[model samples]
Target: MTSISIRSNIQTEIREFLKLAIPLASAQVAQATTGFVDAVMMGWLGQEVLAAGGLATMIFMAMMMTGIGIISGVSPLVAEAYGAKQNRRVGQITRQGLWIALLLAIPGMMIIANLDGLMHQFGQAENIVTLADTYLNVMAWGLFPAIAFAVLRGCIVSLSEARPVMFIVVTATGFNIIGNYVLAFGKLGFPEMGIAGLAVASICAHWIMFLSLLGYMVWHKALRQYSLFKTLHRLEPKTMQQLLWVGGPIGITTLLEYGLFTTLTFFMGALGTPVLAAHQIVLQTLTVIYMVPLAMSYAATVRVGQWFGQRDWQQVRQAAFVSIGLAVMFLIVAAIALFTHSRQIIGLYLNLNDPANANVLNIGVSLMTVAAFGQVLDGVQRTANGVLQGLQDTRIPMLLGTFSYWGVGLTTSYFLGFHTDLAGTGIWLGSYIGIATAAIAFIWRFRGILSKKESRHPINGLTFKE
Candidate 1:
């Protein structure tokens, strides 16, 4: 191609790239907005309520990540199928994921609902246990909808219909905020239910989002082929096995990653209420800022899977490199914004003027500065990991996460926080190290996978068979 022609094609490719990526980014932004609203509304309730809400969220997120990980497995498969023009298989995998989601949610909801009572058996203080329990029970109501939404979301993202998901998520998050205001604080005529109200608002928002996605799927023509409402053949053992094989490790992998953070939060709770509240403030900020790279990762997964389907390895390399470049650029800018606004952002989460929360506000501000760079590495590694998932190289990633989170992240945190004096901030530092290690390992593995001189067996898409 001529230079001008090449530039024109590059521009076209970039636009095409953003077309899918923007919606995915919006969808992630909406997800983060839910937590922002939660924190904002809870801010009106003082540090205790905010701390309680934060604890509840950590517990809920850990459970949600484990359950939702099952659906992530479907994305690469669906993306590859779409790229290969295997429309029927996409529908089939979606069906299987739906069933799996239903099955997974039942147990997940029950486990989280009763987690508090179980925690107290270790002889914890009555107050913290009671608060955590109340939050868990109320949040449990949303579990089914959340899991179902995750499966539907995976199917849609694979089809590159990311825009509609953004619409639903934004709309739902808006309603969630409104509900938090009216119910959590007794705005207008509604009775204030405190933490329970927060829970109710989140639950209602989950259902609304799920129904909205369902409605969109029924009407969208581009998605007609992958509709979940259609009368398809009965469950196939092989299909379920295929999905389970891919999805099982993903679910386990997520549980390992999220579980480590959840454990860290639990340890933070032991430090003091102020520390726990500070951790929550930092976690919410990380989730929001991290979404950009997360969206970039999803885009990478789709593009890579599509290229893999086409057997066009060259395009696959281009897509991976391009996506990583975009993610790095975006996160660097985000890190700068985060560092500059660290104090102001912490102020928003805590009432800086309040006399009772002087300690909480100071600790949160300090942690934000420490957390800023951590999120950048988080973005880098996660997007790189997503690229590997797209290439269907998951086993090693799973091993890395397991070893890094538990062996490196958690172990280092314990030594630094307890053995030394870094405290909760040290825990986050360990997380940075853990993810950085995974990033190096994942990038190396991706290079190795692409550089193999011969075709490998198709089972794991690697040179080795399971």
Candidate 2:
């Protein structure tokens, strides 16, 4: 390649990468903020309420992520089609994703609405079970709005338009926080419904987010040039099948990841209310900080998928590197903040009036410090996984995740915490081991794929038979 050709390619890759990354980062920030807001609001309701909110949130995550995972298949496919300049296919996949989301939400909402009986089956403290059930049932109605928003947002990702989704999420999260204040504390002449109030605020916020995204898609002229409106009439069965194939693994992958945490929560409840409460606080904090890496992963997925569609493997590699590098740097900063001020951060969520409950706050700070490095690794693995997914290399990473989370991680935690003297800290150790293993395996798999592909020159496109 000529010097100029090489320079041009580098510049184009950088520009494309940034075009995808900045918006994804913004969306990630909004997503992270939503978790932080949920925790902060719930924190105000005392230890029991905080614990209840956390448990309920886990169930919500499991249900939502399961369906959203399926819908996530739309992004890479859309990104690939957009890169290939296939306007009709982009529209078709987006439409199919929406339909799938609608169908998925029905069962999701039903499960949430009826989760109380299931919580009892898990065999938890009666009080904890009641609280979890109450919060889940009320919040179950949120599935529709949440799924709708994901469907629309996935379309935006396909088009590489991240800013609008970010705006919609940030605005809705802001309103949700305000609603939390009003509903949770009986402010503005409202009843102080505590955990239930938080659920109500969430449902209202999701509806707002859904409506806002739908409106933007309908009205934005700049977006219309991409044939987003005109191409909606065409739908192809083969293309729909491709969407399902790509999305199915992703849905299962997300369920596997979220399910690990939910299962952990179930176990935590059996340990005691104190441990459960402490874990919730730390989890909330972790979730907030996790948005940075999560955003980077999404960026990697979009950029990698697009480059793959364009048959630009070098650009895909560069995109993955840049995304991972940025994520590492971001998490390093978050780690420092956590390590230096763990106690202070925990204090913000702790109820000082209840001195007897100080153990919860103290344990949270200590456990969070132990969990910090793992969080950094988590950023890496997730972002790397996204890159692989973007390249349509999902099977290996999915298998890796399943093994790491279930085989290595959860099992280690059980053995260490119950069988040994590590107690709660041992549980966190399991996550670290699991994720670290996943990170190594994912990186190796991705690198191996890249190497094999490079050895076979003149390969023009990626073709997955299934």
Candidate 3:
């Protein structure tokens, strides 16, 4: 291609990526707002509530990650089918994805219901364990609906119809905030349920979002031709197997990443109440920012999968590069914002003026400083993971994550927090190193894959068979 043609192509790819990415990023931010709202509301309750709720949330997230990862298979599959103009396959994949969601939910609910023993095993304080258990019991009911919504979202986003999902999520977030106020604090004549009330509100919000998306898929004019409801009763063994083959690795990858963070939460709990509370504040703040790159990653997966299906090697490379470039640029901006306003950000989570919370506030501020430094690498790794998923290259990425997060990251965290004076700072620094390692590995993998010549049957070659 001539220089001008190449420049034009690059411009076109960037425009297309942004069109899909902006709405998706907004939806991610809206979805994350539910958790942010939860933390903020819980923070107002008391330090104990904040710490206990944070622990419970981590467990809930870890469990949900597996389901989200499994359901993630739907996006790539549907996107590829849509690109190939195989509309029937898209419907089939989406339906099976729902079944997978339901299947995953059963065990998830069971585990959370029996979480008391597990939390005790983790050596959490007795009172905090009881509070967390209370929260988890009610929150467990939301798992099925939440995972089901995720599957629907995957299908919709893959088709580049993300606006409805974004609308529903934002609406659900608003609903959740209102519910938290009414149920948690006895507003509008409702009985106050404390942490349990938050869980109840979350459950209600999950079901609402799920139902709203389901209705849209069934009635939306753009999705009408897919006939998504036609094969509701039929079970396709091959397709289900395909989803597991693709989604299982993704689930494991998510588990590994979330597990690392959850483990860090455990380490913080061991340090002290002040340290744990501070850790929660820092984590919540960073998670909200992380949503930006996370959304771009999802967009990258959809865009790359579509290009891959069409056997458009040049566009695939363009999409991958464009997505990564956009994610890094956004992260750079976010990191600077976080670094410059570290104290102000932490102040949102705690009362900085209160003497009792001084230690927590100070620790939180310091952790945010470390978080700012690592934000760019965090965005890079997450976006790279998305790019690889778009190409259906999952297993190797999973392996790389395992080594980086567990082997290097967690080990370093343990040594520093337990064996050295750095303590919490040391642990936070470990995450930076781990993320940087994964980022480098994932980017290398994407470039290696992109450089390969396209095969006649690209999908067959890249994807695993049942």
Q: Kindly list the per-residue Cα lDDT of model 3 for residues 1-466, writing each as its tens digit.
A: 8999999999998988887888888888987888888898888998889999999999998899789997888888888899889999999999998898999999999998888887777778888898899999999999999899989988998998878878888899899989988999999999999999999999999999999999999988878788887869888989999888878889999999999999999899888878988898889888888999999999999999998778687788889889999988888888889889988877777788989988987788788888986988999999999989988888899899999999989998999888998888889999778889999999999888776644433453354332
Clashes of 2: 0
lDDT of model 2 at position 295: 70
lDDT of each: 0.80, 0.80, 0.88
Global CA lDDT of candidate 1, please?
0.80
Question: Weakest 10 consecutive residues, lDDT, candidate 3?
Answer: 457-466
**Once all C-alphas are superposed, what RMSD does model 2 give against the true structure?**
2.5
Ranking by lDDT: 3, 2, 1
Model 1, residue 164: C-alpha shift (Å): 1.0
Candidate 3: lDDT of 343? 81
**TM-scores for every predicted model:** 0.93, 0.93, 0.97
Which candidate leads the pack in TM-score? 3
Overall local distance difference test of candidate 3? 0.88
